[model samples]
Target: MADATADLAGASPAKLTTADGRPLKSALARAQAKARRRAFLLVLPLLLFIVLTFILPIGQMLHRSIFNDGFAANMPQLTQWFVDNPVGTEPDESAYAALAADLKSAAEAKTIGVVGTRVNYEMSGTRSLFTSTGRKAKNFEPPYMQAVLEADDKWADPQLWGTMRQVSDAYTANFFLAAVDLARDTEGKIVQAPEDRRVYVMLFERTFLIAGLITFLCLLLGFPIAHLLATLPLRYSNLLMILVLLPFWTSLLVRTTSWIVLLQGQGVVNNTLVATGILTDDTRIQMIYNQMGTIIAMTHILLPFMILPLYSVMRPIPPSYVRAARSLGASSWTAFRRIYLPQTLPGIGAGALLVFILGVGYYITPALVGGASGQLISNLIAFHMQDSLNWSLAAAIAAVLLAAVLVLYWLYDRLIGIDNLKLG
Candidate 1:
């Protein structure tokens, strides 16, 4: 025993080692690093896919919101003149001369219309000014200010000069300001847009209000169905779930068209009501092609999203808790309110966020059913993209919508924790 003790005392501590003779700690770290690298390699394709498809498009839209070169690219000389001169400077002879040279060059290049169109967005009726001036540009001699003003007396207007100065820069916030129904006056102070042009803010408010109503409707209609499914046997619940999922199998256009048929003035519902003597033919309700149609169609379409989440959260909640509460003299309503309803909140948050986000971005249903007054902000964004062809304004509107969604998502994360969002 003494010899063993002396041997152990004399021996150096045995270092922990792997089979390959490396220290165990180092081996474990290397293994962990290798596993982490393998995991990252497996996920790299998805990351690249998201960056390319989602992140890159959003970044491009954001860049387009502030960067436009219609005036700068076509009228380089005038752009440079604006750079040299400060805002609110009255145009002198040199400024008019620079404008004359730029107009002449733009006319020759056939880009005068492009520059005019760019300026027309900011100051209505200026496209004609740019085009007409370009047409008579070569006739102007020295002392071009007076000669140019002779072509159009409107050129002498300070408001026109201010607008030109504002748009002369290659980058601007005017599109964003316009998106929010604001504009910069000749004095360079931000002000409310003209009352007639103040539509975007109203559209945004309408969009949010409608989306909230749709979310609430979905929750109200879905909660009872979800609770029934949760309480039912698997056989019955599966049959009921098929009813909920049937809408998903149908095309959205087909469903929307069906609603149109059902809701139109002379369509099925009105005809049935009239036949039943519930309403006179002359007093048939006008339902389709309005806000009411949009709400009914969207609620039906989004109901499953609410039902599935609520069902998933409720299924795991044992009935014994409610039964125990009832046995302890609690009323059914009290047991549900205190012991059951709170548990389903995670599902409520998940469903409401999903439905609200999707509803805000809805285009087809609203476009088809929602008439002039019923139209939402997304409709205007599409109008700018397709009809107006003002892509910068479209980008600005889209950027604002995207920002609002991100803010709501951040708020949800803060309040409810994203980890609690369970779809199943």
Candidate 2:
């Protein structure tokens, strides 16, 4: 009994060992960790590439939306004065004195124009005020507030003071507010911008409306084509696929130009209609250089994006399912609605998201085809960046657009799941 007890104790759950006498569990864990490290190392270059090329630029743009140092950096004394004072506090002699000194310094440095330009973005017509004031600030003597007001009564405007206070901080939400067509009043209360200046919100709404329309159009047109392709034999489908891919091989400019040629009044379609008595020469359709032109051009360009995804998802679905439903006494329409439609949802989600995202940022097609009435938010972003030279406002607009897209993506992930987003 004593011997048997000792034997059982010795045999009780001996530590696992590998063939080479290393502990098997520990060895397996080490092997797994090494494999993971190797895999990460292999992907390290790709990760770095994405960070540098994509992530860093987006991060920089988002940062620019809230941060501007044009006034704060250039007008240090005045900025400090404003920071020391509470909002709505009437600027006293000391604040005016500080402003005079800063303006003098900025004028000497030839940077007053930059500061003025920054201020003008928030308060129109203030560019000349800063530049003209700075040019004469050198000759101004004591009783600076009275002297400054004498130079320009505009200096005493509470609105200008409020604008200055708002921009005193190196970081502010003013650009974001401006992006959404909101502003801070003299009392520091948020308010809607004046009617004439309230354009950005409308532009954003139009942008989304256009994108949604394009997405709907793509789905409406793409679904039937994809279904046909999937149902057809491989030999015929491959031939049809070439037609779909043909547009992709063509230059985007060329495609847009082609649409212009086809849709313009003097173009082939209208001329043909005129010759065929469908419409008189005076009654040729007004298509190009309008919303209709934008829609048609974008739909053609983005159709392939929709078709490819739907085709990939549909090609795998067996005909047997539909046949089985039919055998079970289900009507053709009922079988498609219940079984086929549900199965294609993943593809629809992927295609719609891809098309919508692309459409929202569409610049070239809209810029060329979309006239003033048809212009989108991207056109305004470009206008600010190049024409208006309001880069900070442009950056702010881009950041807002990016935030909106991310929110939509997050909602999509929560509802449909990112794992379900499949692409060929």
Candidate 3:
């Protein structure tokens, strides 16, 4: 029995040891190793998913932005016209012949429009250059070149030639510039979009403005609710918390649609206002089809994100902090501001960041409620991708959107770091 007992002791769970068996790892090290493994396992799925869905698509789109060569690839015979130049500043006669041949062939093949449109995506006048030249050129030689020069003194413009030289690739920054409401002139100078078409810049400004407003509303409204949740009795707090979460249980589309029905001209809100005599029967407030509707709907959808984070941070703060401040002869507002408000900064930052980021990319709420002026950048992006069939333009806009979001995130991170230092 003693031998068996000794054997069982030897077989019992042994202390984990290093190779030398000198107490292999500290508790922290063991825990860290377990955490590292768990973290890697937990993140692997998300990493793979993002790579497949986001990273790959973004990379593909960016690649397309600079690629511009469907025509050149299909027609190598026209290349002799472009390259036959004598390697001097003046474009040689052979170069002109090559141009005429290429244009004639391109026009005959019914693919002149593709090249023209692609070039026009960068320089608006390019379509005129190609289209007018093709139609007037009875031959690919002097007459066509003369027509091009006569049609626009821009033919004398070497910069337009430079743009033509660059179109052999399938990608160009033209779409990106156009996405931001800028365009390249014949001289290749980037300038503001024409006065008649300055809508894109306004759209970008509106998107940011709406996002900021929604974030502000979220923080202002959510802070008090979160404070109540953190301070109240656990039962009551939990009930309110459940209510905050209840919206998430319903489909997002359903909620947005409901808001539409509730806020529209003849909807519940307008009817109530009219019945209350605040609004005359014929005087309808335009709430549902404007920025107000978007803000209200988005705020409702995103309030939980703000509340939960603020509540989490506030709950850990003990009531004794406020009591201690009060005992020191601080006023009620002073105690709350000095002792309570500072502790909640982290949650405030987290919740604001969450809501702001979500708001920037909002599409459905804005689309359903936003009339022409209320539409955000995302709506235009969708229109370019689906309605306009302009994938390059859509991709360019998406790239800008991603860049803007990253800049905001970086600023948020910097501010959060500073806040932590102040708190510490």
lDDT (C-alpha, whole model) for all candidates: 0.92, 0.92, 0.77
lDDT of 3 by residue, 306-335 (tens): 888899888989999999999999999999
What are the per-residue Cα lDDT tens digits for candidate 1 across 243-358? 99999899999998999999999999999999999999899998988899889888988899999999999999999999999999999999999999999989999999989999
Highest TM-score: which candidate? 1
User: Any idea what lDDT model 2 has?
Assistant: 0.92
Pairwise TM-score winner, candidates 2 and 3: 2
| Segments of candidate 2 deviating more than 4 angstroms | 1-26, 414-417
RMSD of 3: 6.2
Candidate 1 wrongly placed segments (more than 4 Å)? 1-14, 414-419
Estimate, for each residue in 47-101, the C-alpha lDDT of model 2 and write its tens digit.
9999999999988888888988999999999989987888868999999999999
Quote each prediction's TM-score: 0.94, 0.92, 0.78
Model 3 earns a TM-score of: 0.78
What are the clashing pairs of model 1? none
The C-alpha RMSD in Å for every predicted model, in order, reads 2.6, 3.2, 6.2
